[model samples]
Target: SSFETKEEQEEKMEKSEQAAAAFPPSFSVSEIKNKQRRHLMFMKFKQEKRKQKLQLKKKKKKEREALGDKAPPKEVPKTIENQRVYDETTVNPEDEEVAFDEGTDEFCSYFNGLTNPKVLITTSDRPRGRTVRFCEQLATVIPNAYVYYRRGLALKRVVPQCIARNFTYVMVVNEDRKVPNGLVLCHLPDGPTAHFKVSSVRLRKEMKRRGKEPTEHSPEVILNNFSTRLGHSIGRLFAALFPQDPQFVGRQVATFHNQRDFIFFRFHRYIFKNEKKVGIQELGPRFTLKLRSLQKGTFDSKFGEYEWVLKVSLSAVTVFFKMQEELCCLI
Candidate 1:
C-alpha cells in the first residue's frame, strides 16, 4: 500500500508538471505526444469534470432543501430564442388590422365552415422507397387525405385538376436520392403557397416503443409557437388541412411545434391512467420542416410574388446589417 501510494503521488506530480508546461495559457489532452498517456490523461480529466459537476449539483440540492419553501427560484438558462430581439410582427389579437386580415385571408372559407378540407398528397416524379412510405404515412395522419402518384406531370397542371376536384390543399413531397427532401403546399382556388426544406424524417418502423397504427378518426390539431404574421399565415394553412370538428374519441393529437424557425411534426396518442395521471405514446412518421419561401400565388416560381424568402449567401455580414437597420426602423 505504501509503495502504491508513492507511485500514485509520482503520477499526480507528473500530471501537474504537464499542466504547468502550458499553464496561464492553454493545455489539452491532445497535446500529449504519447497515445497511451493522452488517453489516460483525457479519461482522468473527464472523471474530474464529471465529479465536480455532480458535487456542484448535490450542493445546490442541499442548499435548496435547507431553505425549504424560502428557497430562491431556480435560475433560467439563456438561449437564442429566449433572448431574441423584439419582433414587431407578433400578432396582437386586439389589433383591428390583424383581426381584419385574419377574417379575410385566403383560408377564410375553411375557417367560416363553408367548405370541408380535401387534401391531395402526392410526391415528385417517380418517388421511390422511403418517399412513398412517407406520403402514405402523412395520408394516414390527415383525415380526408388521398395519396396519388405524380406520373411525370407538371405541378402547374396538377394544381388546376386539384381545384376542379374540389381539393382544398395540394401537398407535393419532393425527394432526392430516394429520400424525402422538400415540400410544397399550395392552397386551392387562389393563392399563397409555402415551400419547406424537409429533414430528420423517421418512419413508423424507425421509432422505438411507438404506439399501434392510428385509427380513421380525426386527430386533434395543435399549432405551437407560431407568433409572427408570417407564422400566423402558415399556422392557418396547416389548420385548414383538417376538418373543423375533431373526433375526440380517437385520443390522438397531431402537433406542429415551431422552434428557432424549424417546424417539428409529431403524432401522439394519450390515455388516462387515473384522474391526475396521463400517459402518452408516439405514433410514428416524425419529420422537421423549415420554411424556405412563402409565395403569394400558386406554385409559380418564375413570376410569383414572394411574401418572404429565406436567402443564404456568402455575404451574410451585409445582410445582417441590412436586417438590423430594418429592425431599428420597425422598432
Candidate 2:
C-alpha cells in the first residue's frame, strides 16, 4: 500500500507540472503597473501639447494688441456719417473749441431760426462735411437738434414744412432710413433737408411692416452710405447728363481724418465744383462770407467751405478708396 501511495503522489505531481507547462509566462503585476505608467505618461505628453497650442494662441492675441490691432470681422450696416454739405473754408477754430467745451451738448440749438408755428434750422455753425458729424456738432451746439428724412411720397410732409416752430425742433433728414435711438432736433429748411424725432413705436412699426430690421448700427452706416451713394450718384449723373457744363462737379466722395473726434471720424462728401482751366483753389460757388469767434457749444461755422478741404483731401483718400471699392466690388 505504501508503494502504491508513492506512485499516486508522483502521478499527481506530473499532472500538475504538465498543466503549468501548457501556459506561457503571463504578465507580472509589476509589468502591468509599468504599462499603465507609460500610458499615463503619453496622456500627459498629449495634454502638454494641447496646452502649448492654447498658449500660442494667447501669445498671438497679446502681440496683436501690443501692436494696436483691432478685429476686422464684424459685419455692419450703413450709417449717418455719410452725407453732404456746402463747400467753404477759413473756419475759425476758436468758435469750434468754445462751442464744444462751453455750449450745451445738444444739436437743436444750431437751428435757432424756428418760428412759433414753423421750423427752420439756424445754428451759428451751418452743418457741413459729414452729415452725421454736422448733426453731432449741431447737437453739441443746440440742446436737441435732430435731422429726420423719409423717402417716397407716402409720408405727409410736416405742417411746419421746414425745421422750426413750437415743440422742440425738427429737420428733414434727407436720409433713407430712421436711425435707432437717434435724436437730432433742428430747424430744418423747407423742401428736402428736414429733421424730426422719430417715435420709437412708429419707427419699429415701419421696420416690421416692411419686413426689415432696424439697423443695429444704422446711424453711422446710413449716414456714411448716403454720402457715398450721393457721391457715386452725382458723379454718374454729372458724367452722363451734365457733361457739357463748363464748371463741372467732380466725383462725390466723403473724406475723413483720424482726429479721434466725431467730426474728424466723419466721412464727408467731396464736392469739387470746377472751372475749365481754373486751378483748384481758384474756383467755388459764391457763398456769403461770415466770421465769428468760437464759443462753448459752437464752432467755426465754416461748413460752407467744406468743399475746399475735400478737394485737397481727395488726393489722399482717392487712392485708398479706389482700391478698396474695387476689392469690395469683387467681393
Query: Which numbered prediction scores highest in lDDT against the true structure?
Result: 1
TM-score of 2: 0.20
- lDDT tens readout by residue for model 2, 78-141: 5543343432422332566534532432332322322222222332122223334334433322
Candidate 1 lDDT, tens digit per residue, 1-331?
5657887999999998997564333576688999998888788777777988999999999999999999999999999987998888898767899889988989888899999999999999989989999999999999999999999999999999999999989999999998999999999887689999999999999999999999999999999988898899999999999998999999999999999999999999999999999999999799999999999878898889999999877598898999999999999
lDDT of 2 at 94: 58
Q: Would you list the C-alpha lDDT of every candidate in the order shown?
A: 0.92, 0.32
Off by over 4 Å in 2: 1-51, 55-101, 104-164, 175-331
